[model samples]
Target: MTKLEQIERSIAALCPKELKAFAKWFEAFQADLWDMQIEADGQGRQT
Candidate 1:
């Protein structure tokens, strides 16, 4: 499994009930970081 999937599986096995919250936060964090990276790339290309 991918690292992310492995982590999720581990967490799920340990705390099934909290998986939803973990997923939500993980998605938000990944999306925000991706947006930042894209924005940075745009800035870099413009410079």
Candidate 2:
């Protein structure tokens, strides 16, 4: 199976509490990525 499929299966196996924690972590992870992209865009525009 693909790595993504493995990740999906592993996430599906998480218990309720673990899933909640993972969701929170994932949200923060996404937010950080977004912030970094915005910063990079701003820097590019300054050139």
Worst 10 residues of 1 by lDDT: 38-47
Native-to-model Cα distance after best TM-score fit, residue 16 in candidate 1, in Å:
2.4
Candidate 1 lDDT, tens digit per residue, 1-47?
Answer: 79999977788686655888888988999999888888989888521
Which candidate number would show the highest lDDT if scored against the true structure? 2
lDDT of 1: 0.81
- TM-score of each candidate structure, all chains considered together: 0.61, 0.92
RMSD of 1: 4.0
Provide C-alpha RMSD values for all models, in order. 4.0, 2.9
Global fold similarity of model 2 (TM-score):
0.92
Over all chains combined, what TM-score does candidate 1 have? 0.61
Model 2: lDDT to the true structure = 0.93
lDDT of 2 by residue, 1-47 (tens): 99999999999999999999999999999999888888988888521
- After best superposition, candidate 1 residue 30: deviation in angstroms? 0.1
